[model samples]
Target: MNKLPPEALEHVANYFRTLSEPTRLRVLNVLGTSELSVGEIAQLVDSSVANVSRHLAQMAQHGLVARESRGNSVYYRVADPTVNELCDLVCGSVARRFDQVVSAHAAFVASTAPARRRRAG
Candidate 1:
């Protein structure tokens, strides 16, 4: 990224920005698993067909997803498989942080339990 020119860096930023939306993330998650029609994606994402189609169009433009037309239906899939890798890395980091928080919370409760019991007794 430091090696890239300003214009290329801006494009990279836009690519990440494209994935920042919750709905777009959900759409990509579904595509990572299987190719689906816009309707199918809409159903799984708990959104409307029109809304999902709009998201797909933008994602396709960004080269984040691929679209295929079959008769009256169109299907979408993740164009860059590396996106799953990126998601896995991020999710793993978040999961580790959550585990740390959970462990801390459990330890705090254990430390306070004896104090609470003594007060009651």
Candidate 2:
């Protein structure tokens, strides 16, 4: 990225922007496991089929995922394996941070509980 030209940097930014949507992220999570039809994805994501189809189209346009046509139905799957790796890294980082936050909150509550109890007694 540091060596990328201005236009290349812009393109990279746009790529990240495409992954920034919640609905798209949810769709990706589903695709991470197995390829699924738009209706199946919509059911899992609790969205309408039309809405899921729109999300898939946007992601497919960005080459983040690919779709297969079977008869009249389409099944989407992760196209770029690197996207899965990127997602794994990001998700792992977030999960670790969340665990740290939860632990810190628990410790703070535990430390304060004794003080509050002492003050009451």
Candidate 3:
């Protein structure tokens, strides 16, 4: 891969920052491959319409989402398809780490069980 210049790196960082919010990620997940109005997205994400709108606007500005006006409502969809791929990669990594942690904890508990039984007896 080619190295990015300092300014380009900053832009990349800002783009990642845009996706760093839980609400925005939820909005993307809610959107998936379908275009939905702000109200519909808000209901699906269990957030206030106003709050979802704000997040949608921010995502739109970042070029992460696209919006269209239909009658009185603005509908949104994911603009950068690669965003979903990126999220999937991160989610897989997180799941692996979580499993590793759980396994380690279970092993620790198993190891301590015998000692505890011995002490009690």
List runs of model 2 lying over 4 Å from the truth: none
Specify the highest-TM-score model's number: 3
The per-prediction CA RMSD against the true structure, in angstroms, equals 1.4, 1.3, 1.1
Question: Which 10-residue window in model 3 sums to the lowest lDDT?
Answer: 1-10
Candidate 2, residue 99: CA error in Å? 1.3
lDDT for model 3, please. 0.94
What lDDT, from 0 to 1, does candidate 2 have? 0.92
For model 3 the TM-score comes to 0.95
Per-residue lDDT of candidate 3, residues 1-121 (tens digit): 1788988888888899999999999999989999999999999999999999999889998899999898988889999999999999999999999999999999999999999999999
**Candidate 2 lDDT by residue in tens digits, 1-121:** 7688999888888889999999999998887858899999999999999999998888988899999999998999999989989999999999999999999999999989999999999
Off by more than 4 A, model 1: none
Model 3 stretches with alpha carbons more than 4 Å out? none
Error of 3 at 25 (Å): 0.7
Q: Cα lDDT of all candidates, in order?
A: 0.92, 0.92, 0.94
Indicate the worst ten consecutive residues by lDDT in candidate 1: 26-35
Error of 2 at 109 (Å): 1.6
Please give each candidate's TM-score: 0.90, 0.91, 0.95
